[model samples]
Target chain A: MSKTVEIRWHGRGGQGAKTAALLLADVAFKTGKYVQGFPEYGPERMGAPITAYNRISDQPLTVHSNIYEPDYVVVVDETLLESIDVTNGLKADGAIIINSQRPKEELLPLLNGYQGGVYVLDAREISIRALGKNFPNSPMLAATVAVSGVMGREDFLGEMRQSFQHKFAKKPEVIDGNMMALELAFNQVGC
Target chain B: MAIRERLSGNEAVAYAIKQINPDVMPAFPITPSTEIPQYVANYIANGEIDTEFIHVESEHSAMSATLGASAAGARALTATSSCGMALMWEELYVAASDRLPIVLALVNRALTGPININADHSDSMGARDSGWIQIYAESNQEVYDNFLQAFPIAEHKDVMLPVMICQDGFITSHGVENILLVEDDKVKEFVGEYEPEHYLLHPTEKMAVGPYAVSNYYMETKRAQRQAMLNAKQVILDMAAKFEQMTGRKYGFFEEYRMEDAEYAIVIIGSAAGTCKAAIEEIRATTGKKVGLLKIRVFRPFPEEEIAQALSHVKAVAIMDRSEMFAGSCGPLGAEVRAALFQAKSQAEVVNYFYGLGGRDITVQDFMQVYDNLENIANTHVVTGMYDYIGLRER
Candidate 1:
């Protein structure tokens, strides 16, 4: 068996599904795991459903297709639950990280009897407060690493720092602020 | 040593992009071509390849951001399909006419409205008139190889036209097959390091890529662009030959199969040629009849002279087109083939079959059916695909 943890993310075109997946893989690599992050595309117009995936492993991985049954599913937009089936073909032992204003009880039925581990957070509010934007990719990914117990909270922060520093290297403050957002989300939802 | 892997054209495209190590990649995923960008992003994140993968909002922006990166003198690339290609249509033309060497991989799909997500050439046909140099591939290997050749072709000083390497959506892009890749060193040598002369964002160099050519010289500038595109023909042949010598794999503008001593032939492009080859062989064995398959690997800078020479002796030829040029009487490829052979001495009966629109699977048997129809129609009139008659739409 491979030492990778495969993640599948569901969201609309503009909701940063692909970004969140890439950030998770970047963080995983910084923690010394081989990773793969990508997205599935169709007529990916704005507001259309889309999926992005990540594979994190200690060793190299051979799986290169779409994540059919992923180890973790990150739902960036809770509204995707209505038209799109976010939880379909999820691994039995997988965990789902969702962005919702409501608690787990309110969102469980929307998952259609998905019995895997569930961690819910209002990443939208977190993004607005921490970064002054509606982009919840960084916070949601941080919450995922925290809930899934994939890596320590400290290592997750370190990875976020490295990734943010490089991505927005032009804007150090932006990187610093996103790192703060990751810490806040990590503190709000502990593994 | 390079690893042998079973990958789809989309995956091969992703693999090539990874090797190129682009500075920026932004692709709005469309079916057939979606997997290319996805794989590149994953590869970048995993540290398999170091690159910046931008998750752009739309295909138009995907192309726009790639232009931005390319203009900044960074190796930038992107992919799209069907409507996504249409969305990028205006920008794609600008990226080319402005002589920005942006490499784009287009997974060919039918454009929307009837909204078919299947394999076809409609997307590419829409951009055929765009100033971009277009190269078509028939397999996963071709996808990998053509992309390896595209960078140099696009960035060539005399031919600074943007290049679009196209493969059929699901037929070639989605189907998985084993392929032998050229060694990485060979790929690097074949494409060479990208050194931009007039990048937009470079501060030290005072140069411009996209400048307004007014009416007085717009036509002259357009003439220069055309001359540059024509100049690429020899460069492509030279590079493809060099690639063959290095990799022990032969590529050509046209790949002729069983074209010897044939009185009749089938001419088409894309993955459909694979089916035609199989059907021709089966028909020959059973009936001892001689028919050939002419696969058009290069669409633009249409290989008219070679095609005419190849079919000069054949009595009849059938052109299989996956997309229809609605306003015109003939399908796009069919019209081009007929025009190419119009001046040939042999009066070959050329018939056009416009089936398999929008990813409809065209099997070997379908080719045999068309071949059979070609023989009967050679002496009579043209036979076309069944159209929705006045009463057919009600069903």
Candidate 2:
């Protein structure tokens, strides 16, 4: 494992790229890990492409700049693959997890010359099946953790439940569905 | 042992305020710093602390209310960033001239005109001559710790002046990280209670606060204010030493990182120090160059002698500035360090570089370039332009 794990999330503005990045850091902080989670800020609208970042480390993190050479990338909306250079400046040995129904081989063309682990999952279908909605951020986050091995699947699930409980306090059903979707994606992610 | 929590810089400052639980807090919202007041408001509403928060209409009124509460002998505080702080421009001088010891949690952002809401030192640096003490923090922990220590420095008997504790706007203000929090009771004991020798609310003493001084007294009043700021240099050192003993987190006017017997060094401020440290680490690993860093934690009361002494040993020093000073020399920091080195008559060839204006990203390679320039000067001692900008799209 690297001394620090830098993760970049590519997704549309309305999607939970910011949420996933921040939630991952929040949970990491709870486990006594040093973390930084921030979205690259611009005057972005609802559906525009946006990026968020995370720096998770066992020791104190001294780098306060944005992550350019991310160790892992999570593409919450696979549509972003066509436009943004999702693998730009990504480390050669880094891994990527894409939330897509398409096979890993199908997504390989988009990440040319990456030469890294590629994990694919039908995160949207998983979330829709469990939550009756199209939102796949929580499940994509779970997939990210499972594929990157930055943290244990159980640790991710436990933190996801706690985060959802606090965030969706008034909607108990929403919280349960998010938890279910997170676990499903975690179990199903594969290259 | 301290309690550990995940908090953004604003949340950490709010937590410090919660522990201080000062008598009054006058607040108005501005980007980056807006969350600070929001969190404090929530803290007040939740009964976590008993700070009387005055929701003012504008940033000017926020500072005015803070001055009023402080003049009335209450420990008062406020928060603002960028334009909000600019709005309080006139009052910033008043808070210091009146010798009111108030703590302003300033989230450093770019000032208006071309209008960007990102991290820069222009906001606080613009007020560098406003007779207020300024301290810059590099991390969320320093943000919390600096806020706690600022009170003693400003309120000391010899230095009854206002202080601004600044952290990068969205960089530190909105960015989340793990922070160690001092126990509430321990902080309370350390800060103690606010006791001003003279106050507007004093029952037996008839006195004036923020009064108009005639020509005869105006210069002397200004001089007294200047002297107070000068006296604060030592007071800050004393307070930081005491605070370090309490929390095991040492602080000073400036921090020297890996500077022993170094031939090249860079002096920087605020959040960018972390990035430079990373660059220095990488450079030292690959090239084995003897590079070091001198990050100025206290910008005001400039720490001229101390900083000059520290950088005097290096062969070539580059004072990095986040904001532009268009005056041909580097920005404010570069300008001052040049003057300080002149006073010390140090032979180090100094250059200035301005970067990250209006939130431009400065990468590790960019800093490595700065170090390379310094290394060249150290070897040949041929100085280039007085100043240069990093990562600019120049022809």
How accurately is candidate 2 docked according to DockQ? 0.79
Model 2 lDDT per residue over A1-191, tens place: 55999999998898989988888898878766889988887776898888899999998888888889999999998988999889898888888888898988888999866898888889889989999988888788888888777778777778778888898888887888888898888789842
Q: What are the TM-scores, per candidate, against the unseen true structure?
A: 0.66, 0.96
- Prediction 1: B-chain TM-score: 0.92
Best by DockQ: 2
Which residue segments of model 2 deviate by more than 4 Å? A165-173, B30-33
Give the per-residue lDDT of model 1 (tens digit) for B312-386.
888788887778777445778877788888866558877777766776666666778767777776757555542
RMSD of each: 11.8, 1.7
How far in Å is the alpha carbon of A129 misplaced in model 1?
Answer: 49
What is the lDDT, from 0 to 100, of the residue B107 in candidate 1?
88
- What's model 1's lDDT at B158? 76
RMSD of 2: 1.7
lDDT value, residue B237 of candidate 1: 82
